[model samples]
Target: MTYDRCLATLKAISGREAASGYSQRALKQVFGTSKVTFPLSYDRQEFFSKSVEYSKGISISGVQEKLSLRLDRASNELVVTRNNGEYILKPSPEAFPNAAENEHAAMLASQKIGIETALCTLVPFKTGELAYLTRRFDRLESGDKRPQEDLLQIGGLPPKAKYDVSYEKAGELVDQATGGKRAVKLDLFRRVLFAYAIGNNDLHTKNLSLQRAVESSSRFYDKLTPNYDVLFVQAFDNTKEGQFMACDLLTDPETGEEEFTEPYQEYGFYTGYDFLELGRRYGLPERAVIRAIRNQVDSQGDMIELIQSSYMPEEMKREAEVIVVGRCRAISTGIDR
Candidate 1:
């Protein structure tokens, strides 16, 4: 909430110590300019007033309030725009505490574990509150919008049904849509494992998506889009009642029963074997499955390190670390353990 020497570093925008502000590398990546900070042309009061009118007819999905904006390199400022915006800004949701910092930290952690994530960072509003900002991966350098579709629409489901589908079914739909691309399936498997490891229980159908391949001639989108909308939901209060995963990972499709390994039944959490079973069900090779699970397990320290150095409040950072460690432990051990 307060500015420090390591603000940009803590936000995961800069890897090195940025004593003055954002490092050159980070500034180049996010702003495509030499700006020290992403100063907005509008203040918080103006943003709050204008965003309401700007949000109408905005096609972007999700429950968070979003404003589309474009970077003016000539002026070195980000300005609100109703059309052809290159970035999506998410101010902290009133209902969700520290949502902006939570998302920025989680997204960087996801990238650390090898998940392809949308380029994002935490930008300070003129009022000093931090907001989550992500570049629109669906847009090109020429300001052209790429063909992109979330899994919900691809599966012919409405927004209300986003939470109704299972990962197994979603993966199946993705396989069909992508023409059974093995690499895409493998990436999907890794993403699912990463989501669970981070205690991101909000990775429903609408969160996963595909974009049209830049080189392809086909009309269908055959490429998986970068991961987005990821954050640690367990850091919030009163969020522990639901299942571990957003979808029915433990459900037996044929029997319509939730299946749990012996350790799961005893300990009441998924073990490494459960993840292995899921990879197998998703038709990923055994070696790849083992590797993906190992990737998540091995990145435990990195995830915690990011959380500790994040812009989240101290209490929330500690809570997030505990949640991530618990999930990582759950996913690292076998059923026998």
Candidate 2:
């Protein structure tokens, strides 16, 4: 949707309803600022477009229609990521509407919530004539400034397994993929929260990544990066609740389960996260969890704006709210029944 239409819709919604109790950060996401417009000189569908021959691993087939793979530049993302071999090309007038915009919002939301995620910034792509592209977390071993552009989701444990089916399995996979050096505490929780907050139900085992950063500028740091690939696919399909929740096998922490076992089973999702126990393990506070929830609620407008600008129509927008806010709220204060 155009900025004018987005604003008008929000105005209409705001006038019709009142703040339904959201977090401050969530509110900012609903209408904080303009999406950073990326410059692009390359059009993927152009008559003279060039298709580079990189390994096609585990990306959603046919998604490149709206995105092109290319190297982009920006100072902000420089320090955050180390050696991404390739950067995903995101062109303007993109094949799909508002995907790039929604992604940008997801990353910004991750940062706002104190998650240890990759540094992200919108930059021009396609020779700075077409549109903007979001970079990846993988580093290039080939030694060219433009990383090889291997899709991060393709790098999960055991090479090409899904994470959504079982998180404990994912934990073990993380150890295997990274050769036993998993940043369990920081990496896992952030990913869990990010998936919930951004509505990224597609976070299958393949979607989450484990980077082996170069120790001597050659040996990669064998651990997970903050988080990436943050867009809600459930929005595209009518499945807006972001399915794939289950009673995953709860692992045996004391026994030190094998690193590759699919420990958790899929139990149904609880409306909100009760971090009281989880927070204690990480030395994090339950208040922090509450604060995060509040931020998501408060900045819901910005989140709404991002969605409104994307392929999501106004009707779907209301549906998204029913699921997103409703589910989030259900978990937050339901200390008892």
Candidate 3:
């Protein structure tokens, strides 16, 4: 089925059937794609371990292929409606350390240096906050039923939902998501690099998506989703203890607007690990990884100085630098990968 049909179906299901053709069309573009095939690769074990090793600085959702919705956000993808039309809420969060702003900064920087990103809108939330939300590329695969969860169900074993999908399966998943007719983008290479340099470790299947479709019944094709959730570890003070690393995530549940800085956790992290692993998943060269590490070290001062001036105090900024820079040096040269 064509993506237009899929859009029609999803909109109907969401009770947005009467939401105006133009609005629905806008939504359709978010999930549309050219149909084509391009070879891809993966390595889950490497990604998982590296994700943790790389995340040694903060709690992360572990890499996901897509940000599929559950029963909770069952109705709408971006905004939530309730009260039987009495009230509606959007997915915007009113919190510290803007995730969208960092994403925009990072994307602009990455693209300036020639990186590929589907690109996204800098949407403002009701809370006066902004967060980058990428569109889902995978279609409603519950037999093309257009269920919201279908987005999450991709990348797993066949005839099964929620099957284990790994990094190695990334290529295959990309094929299906992109309709086997999309170009193999080199910008993704830069995305992996820039994400590391900026510490946007939230790279997962959901965060990364494809836009595939067959317009006018011509053919199928796809491309990776735009960069979203590009928040940086340095965006906040990060001074809270036990907030960094994969171990901390695997161990407990956390709540609070704490600093992503140090005392770090028992794992010893100053910032976040996404910086290191973003390169690892793509099989980045050791030279590249080392270069990224060194670059961050060199640039940390400027970054910290900037942060101190804006969102944090001098002591908080200094602590972040010590934890992040000192430990990064230790790990960068010694990492086995």
Best by TM-score: 1
Question: What lDDT would each prediction earn against the true structure?
Answer: 0.77, 0.43, 0.37
Q: What is the lDDT of candidate 1?
A: 0.77
How do the residues 135-158 of candidate 2 rate in per-residue lDDT, one tens digit apiece? Answer: 444534464332121223434234
- TM-score of model number 1: 0.90
**In model 1, which range of ten residues has the least summed lDDT?**
12-21
lDDT of 1 by residue, 120-158 (tens): 877777666778888889887777877788999999998
Candidate 2 global lDDT: 0.43
List ranges where model 3 is wrong by over 4 Å: 1-92, 97-100, 118-151, 156-172, 175-189, 213-221, 238-337
Candidate 3 has a TM-score of: 0.38
Q: With candidate 3 superimposed using the best TM-score fit, by how many Å does residue 68's alpha carbon deviate from the native?
A: 19
What are the TM-scores, per candidate, against the unseen true structure?
A: 0.90, 0.56, 0.38
Q: How far is each candidate from the true structure, as Cα RMSD in Å? A: 3.1, 9.7, 16.4
Backbone clash total, candidate 2: 75
Instruction: Pick the lDDT winner.
Output: 1
